[model samples]
Target: MATPTQVPGWIAVDWGTSNLRVWALDDRANILAETQSPLGMNAIAGDEKLSFEGVLISLIDAWLPSDARGVPVVICGMAGARQGWLEAPYCDVPARPSDLAQGAVQPNVRDPRILVSILPGLCQRDDADVMRGEETQLVGFMDAHPGFAGWVCLPGTHSKWARVSNGEISGFRTYMSGEVFALLSQNSILRHSVKEGWDDGAFADAVRAAKVQPASFLHSLFTVRARALVARDGAAVAPGGAVLSGTVIGAEIADVLGLLQPGEEIALIGAGKLASLYQAALGVHGHKATPMDGTAITLAGLTQAYHTLKTASERI
Candidate 1:
């Protein structure tokens, strides 16, 4: 067995649909190096024997110190699944810190000394949807806000509104707002109609329109192009751009925020663009929003899972 000093360092990875992000951290959790690859789960589709071990080894080989080839590594996100290298089963709703830590680790076929653990996704019965990677964000949130208690909004392609009480994820819901927006803006007829640049003024105006008439999201989305062409004299050529941005985001906030009572704390997770948009919308509805770095949260999540596993191994 490699001595503690000889173990090199821990590796944290957030392997998702579109990209594979890897971080090399010292024992202190400070990042020493990082790398990314386009070998996302989505890109590997159609291949019957997609070898995650091969992808990981290739990435790690470039970064790993020659002497620390045996260092243990931990991974989160889609890497743990029936489609992934090994299935890390879903932890049920209202998952506790202990519950989150109780996941299985599978060794890579290419390297046995390279211990790997995959974080389990979340499943809730309140909705038909499921979340694979957002749970790590939640773990990261809990780690940052040790005693933080309240609800958090993780905005993304599939936005998740999670309720946490006393450091445990008590419940949550998922909205297909991002997916819907993508489909409408890129795949649907609205693709040809909208302008390319972002107009804050236009976006805000569209938000106001959605707020006043919630039911018009779908109907009003098409009007973006029409409004730009006929009403604004092509000034709003990016009609779909502003309209889709406002309608989908505004409508989602209106629908999800309804679950909260007066003065409920809301935390926003993800990149600045998406989180800032949600922050603006929440502000409009009289809610104060706190922003957390999505990447930081993901790293913290990996740390949490690692610590949990360490603790469990000690107990066993």
Candidate 2:
């Protein structure tokens, strides 16, 4: 039964595969209320088309005023995926991230209090790579560093490495390092060997080893269990997590090294721990990375889209 101090002019949403976040914002872009849900795109029942809208309303119904009509809801991320509420097609790369508003798609909604628009993700045809939510973070970063031109890395379950030049993403690559780490640590035989703690020395050394022998990267993964088994008093237990992490991330960096210029600027977009891990790993290879808060940048990107849409409506 919570209510905002003022009626929100619009809403901002970032709906991913596993989670959904919504914000009620005033006309000046200040947040009046915010909330999140586990009912992501994947959470909606496959046979129910109206499920997505229902889940959204259930989470934000309190924020909706009875007399207000068509409060704009700007959404980004997997909510626009092929399996999502409505498939907002990909906008090809080599394009300005802010231009995503031009291709935004409106989904069918029964609610009179809200009008939803989903932003299109970016794609690179020749490379056959695609991204959804990360583009918003990239656009937000560009809002802060409009002149930045270099590697922009966002680490997560599916990490993204994008190249930016003149405010447009020229190309990008995705890595399954985080997902791989999760699988190996949770599902594989390494599950028993790897634990919660991190060891910096073991991590840095593993990074060097993986970088030097990228071809044997797969071979190195098994050592997590082997190292744990052979050591006395479970000495290798704590370092197992770090070693596994370093190996995968190291190999990812190895593949991208050729694409980077000497002494180039690198923008690392993510939260504290993962970003710090990447910053440290990149440091091992003589690279310096500048970090930006993930949530702030995402909101900035959504804010940019809101303004763009607002201005366009004014023009019409």
Candidate 3:
């Protein structure tokens, strides 16, 4: 909760497919308070009873200023999608992240105390790829590591691998490794074999095998089950999940390796188990990944946008 003395200078939001996270920040962009909801764009879009403004007000009403002056509410992610609050058009690649705030679109709202702006996502025409929330995180990372030029990997359901030169994102590629893994482990035949528990050795081995014989990825996936059934080994049965994970992740990395420069640095932006997994997996290929926290990067990005927009408005 934010006390009166800690009145937020503005609000930062990361509204994604399945989650909505909000943060109250002071003039210096320090977080005062934060909250989240499962009612993301997908949920709100499917339910007629839910309205974007209504949901936002419900979550942040208490944080709104008592004065008439409106507080800026800077949002990133799917909230700017075509089906979101209002379409914040895509900013094409070779675009600077700090400049994304200039493309932000404001939606009409009944609230007098809140002025909202949704940041535009990044897009590539030739490759026909797009990203929403992840761009903001990249902005934050680039801000922290100025002059960085290399590959930046954001691992998720639809993992993104982007190339940064100077300070602009030249291009990127997406992989559905996470989503595919989920379907295979939960909805596909592998569900029966996949179990809870992790075997570092099994995972590493699967990664190496995938790298060596990338063409066999499809067939190797089935081995997660076959190895469990025939071998009856504790390592195979208990860590089937790890093996499956490694297989897909390894395949993703193997494909992405072609895009990397011979000795270029890789920035792995994420946190928790997923980031750790990627760090280790990349390590297997003898490429050390520099890890960064996803949340912090996102907040830094939103903060960056807020300041950029604010400064522009102030100049006018």
Candidate 4:
């Protein structure tokens, strides 16, 4: 075991639905250690009899340094929900990193010396939706682009398109495109309807179809099966078949793109492949796209939350 001298200055955590990410940082904000585990909300939700605090303690004990037992820790994401350890209430839209930090929920745990603060998620009355983890990504984006003013597209299970001005998240909308795609490709009849591989030409063709005839999105989706049946003997599309699948989704994105003002910049946040696909779709609609890794932004947001908490404490 390491001595007290080796203990980290602080701990940052991004606990979400399927994974737990922890980072041990020094006073200067450099990460000295990092760990991840499968103790996500899904695992905890599966065992409702166990209090969330108990599950968290077990997970933290397995990962945190013994010497760093009493270090301050800050957390972001679902860990702050009503179903989680403590209820960190939601902050309304046009929120800032400081707003979330100020709304941190401090849970009463066995380790009294360990300071733990959970950041709140973002909600907008206008949008009639809520975003828990994505707000952290927006915080990190603001950190990277200090004076940026434009729209950001965070494509994921629930894709979010946010409008940011100065450093605050002004407005946003969530689309179920990613989740819809997942369901159609994996669970719905469409699974067996398309070929296994992607073809750029076919994808571009579908994109074009969707863009021109967006009202046909639902109609065009089902036709993929008909196309495979007639053209490929009921087999999925050949090598370029995946592109056809993308076209249907790309068409939906094209419809949304019409709402944006001309010259508005768009930033895509997610894994590289998904971001690239969205970039391609956005390009087809004549919008410039920038991509950032979702994980990096989450970590950066957690770090920003920690700093915000530390500053608030100092002020108090």
lDDT of each: 0.76, 0.87, 0.89, 0.75
lDDT for residue 88 in candidate 3, whole number 0-100: 96
How many steric clashes between backbone atoms does each model show? 3, 0, 0, 4
Which candidate number has the best TM-score?
Answer: 3
- Local accuracy of candidate 3 as per-residue lDDT tens digits, 1-316: 4443556799999999999999988998877888999999999999999999999988888876667458899999999999999999999998897668899999999888899999999999998999999999989998899878888999999999989878888899999999999999999999987767889988898888888998998899999988867874555354889899999999999988867886667899988889889999999989888678899999999999999999999999
Per residue, candidate 2 scores C-alpha lDDT tens digits across 52-80 of 78988998899987887899999999989
lDDT of 2: 0.87
Clashes of 3: 0
Per-model TM against the reference: 0.87, 0.92, 0.93, 0.88
Which prediction has more favorable TM-score, 1 or 3?
A: 3
Tens-place lDDT digits, model 1, residues 275-301: 888887777677778677898998898
Worst 10 residues of 2 by lDDT: 41-50
C-alpha positional error of residue 215 in candidate 2 after TM-score superposition, expressed in Å: 2.4
TM-score of 3: 0.93
Model 1 misplaced regions, further than 4 Å: 1-7, 48-50, 62-70, 228-240
lDDT of 4 by residue, 79-104 (tens): 88777778789999878878988889
Ranking by TM-score: 3, 2, 4, 1
Residue 47 in model 4: shift from native, Å?
1.7
